[model samples]
Target chain A: MTTLRRVTLDVLKPHEPSMLAFTERVAEVESVDGVTASLIELDQEVQNVKITAEGAGLDYDAIEAAVDGLGGTIHSIDQVAYGEHVVEERRTLQDG
Target chain B: MTTLRRVTLDVLKPHEPSMLAFTERVAEVESVDGVTASLIELDQEVQNVKITAEGAGLDYDAIEAAVDGLGGTIHSIDQVAYGEHVVEERRTLQDG
Candidate 1:
């Protein structure tokens, strides 16, 4: 079985829930062992954050629903890793 | 003692040694468990690569020496994680 080990997403969320609270909510999702959300930018209305979630076999839909429950919108799924372990993305020359 | 878990470096090296050979050489270092090298750029003279080495307790000086032995210069140490486990770098809003 192809297991999702990690995922990184760009998300936009309201300021009502603090970053700590938001991270805790995501970490509570089943299959998720850990979650980290870093504030990228923020305005009066919303904040942009980069979120990374890791697990043995992450369920994307469940994670999405959890983010939705917090009134957050996922801008993009930046990176994903599947299989026996989480493989980090290597920046190629084209990234420059 | 704080153990070095992982290190990502920008390296420049001659085309003589293939990426596979370079990675293998680095992986052979005393404390490194695994090493991955991705081609970032290449010219007639040299190839620029992004190298990530991981282990329970990585020795940076030894890794540097291995690269040096291969006629590779460590352009920059982009990232380093020292702890119980490897921590991914979280991109923040200020990154933009």
Candidate 2:
């Protein structure tokens, strides 16, 4: 079976939880080994954050649930790596 | 001492040495454990490729020399991860 090793997500979240608490909540997901969340932009209503999680076999559903539980909504799945290792996305010539 | 665990580079190379050969040569660098090269664009003159290498402690100078030896030029150091492990770059709101 194919296993997801790492995933980067663009998420929109409220300010109540704080970035630290949001990252902690996501890191507590059963399959996550470690997670890093960075604030990209913030306004009065929401904060746009980038979250990257690494694990042996990540369960996206559970990760999504965790984010939803924290009043966060996934805007997009920016990148994903599967199989034996996590592969980082490289900037290509076509990328703007 | 700080250790560079992974690096992604934007490189331009002639067609004489195929992408496979170029990747193999970079992978053979002393500090490079593994490498993945993907062609981003190609013209009659040169091929623009993205090369990502991972290791315990990567030597950028050596990696540069290897590319230079292969008739390739490093265009840009796209991303780098330094420390205990390789960290994938996440998409931020500021990114185009």
Candidate 3:
């Protein structure tokens, strides 16, 4: 059986506007914050986006709606060790 | 058996300084960001802190050290639903 592991979704879109739109929607989840969306390359028709949302703020239904709204497909979701980030760090200033 | 579910830790200290000190250390994790520590209550000697960190950046061992370093007790660590907040909410400006 496919392990029900949480993954980080990397979305790609044909335009930056759509990608940004999608990212904005995904950031609305309660636990989600400090989301950063950047453009990668222009050589391809789709723009690349790297999203970092809180495991607490992740919502699948909202993500599906946002992706479809942007007319984009979820290219991939990379599962990182999210638990390591479950604690607080007030010493440094790292944009959440 | 107690499931190994991720939990949200709310730390209390005798002084806001120690609580802040504790929080600062927790934010260093790679996935931790947008950490906010607010004080609550008076009359008593200790301070109350509400910390929100990214699950992706949490480090348990470090948290243990920081908490111990503060010469404070964790008191209570309330388990909050961290995964539901995993999605991005670009639509809102809720600090990460």
Candidate 4:
């Protein structure tokens, strides 16, 4: 079977649910191995955030439901990695 | 008033329509300034992707609609930046 190894997203959300909690909630989804959230913008009413998830055989629908349950709106998908095997970050020779 | 300046997302999509066309469709939404997309993984069935959008007072709903129209499902929101001014990447002291 094909697996969704990694996914990154842009989210608009309310401040009531802390980023940590949100991240944790997403982490709880089946097949998700880890989650990371970074604050991009914050004002009085809302927060703009980036969330990245990595795992094996990720269930995209379940992840969506979790985020929606937290009152967050997903704006866009920034990146995705998927296949029968795990994903590895690619770097150029300049980095070495 | 509040503004949604930037957003990053993980998306699940079909290969048809091409990434370029999909990106252009999203860019046409009202209030969007720019968009960027990176390929995370590609298999015979689907493509997992990351999409980033930056703009002033972004209309999140409009963006969502456009993405949906393209037969894409947003998997997660990865990051966000918003406020009166533009978003600038913040670096740590170690970087300097």
Worst 10 residues of 3 chain B by lDDT: B1-10
Q: Largest DockQ belongs to which candidate? A: 4
The C-alpha TM-scores of every prediction are 0.53, 0.52, 0.36, 0.50
> Chain B alone, TM-score of each model?
0.95, 0.92, 0.57, 0.87
Interface RMSD of 1: 8.7
lDDT of 2 by residue, A2-26 (tens): 9998888889989878665576677
The candidate scoring highest on lDDT is 2
What is candidate 3's CAPRI-style docking category based on DockQ?
A: incorrect
In model 4, what lDDT does residue B65 have? Answer: 93
Per residue, candidate 3 scores C-alpha lDDT tens digits across A1-96 of 011112245666767566556677666644455456655555457777665454543445566566667766665443222223333323222222
Q: Tens-digit lDDT track for model 3 on B1-96?
A: 222223345556655454323555554444454344434333367655544544543555566566666765665665433443443324346543
- Which lDDT value does model 1 have at A82? 48
Rank by TM-score, highest first.
Answer: 1, 2, 4, 3
Can you give the lDDT of residue A53 in candidate 4? 70
Q: List the candidates ranked by lDDT, beginning with the highest.
A: 2, 1, 4, 3
For model 1, how does the per-residue alpha-carbon lDDT over B1-96 read when each residue is reduced to its tens digit?
A: 899987888899898776545666776788876565666667789988777777789889999999999999999888788998876666678665
For model 4, the docking class works out as: incorrect
Model 3 lDDT vs. the true structure?
Answer: 0.49
lDDT of 2 at A29: 78
